[model samples]
Target: MVDENAGAIITVFVLGVVTVLHLLGAVPARLVLIFGLFAVVLLLAIGLLVLGEIRDGMRDAR
Candidate 1:
């Protein structure tokens, strides 16, 4: 849906900004480490959400 795509775009944008900050040493090393861990969890949650949506779509198609 349009709303979902919009949310994904915002999420990607934020992740990009965080990554740039980490790369530029703008963020503290320890805090960057914590962000990295959070990024992993965030990615996994996004992946599961996408997979679930796909499965539901497929069921509807049947």
Candidate 2:
């Protein structure tokens, strides 16, 4: 089973880093926004995939 908590933590960490970079002017505003959105989407996709796996596993167990 995938670790949902770990995925969330990593997503948060990446978002924080992106924000810091934006604040430091290391990355363009548009790029930062894109990355942030991408991170959120990725996290959601991963969570869904994990849930699907869990569901499949449960079905197989029966």
TM-score of each: 0.61, 0.68
Top lDDT model: 2
Clashing pairs in 2: none
Off by over 4 Å in 1: 1-26
Clashes of each: 0, 0
Cα error of candidate 2 at position 36, Å: 0.8
Residue 56 miss distance in model 1 (angstroms): 0.5
* Most accurate candidate by TM-score: 2
Native-structure RMSD, model 1: 2.7
Model 2 per-residue lDDT tens digits across residues 1-62: 34766777787787888889889989778877887888888788887888898899999999
Q: How well is each residue in 1-62 modelled by candidate 1, as lDDT tens digits?
A: 55656766676667677778978988767766676676667667777888999999999999
Clashes of 1: 0
Reference-based TM-score, model 2: 0.68
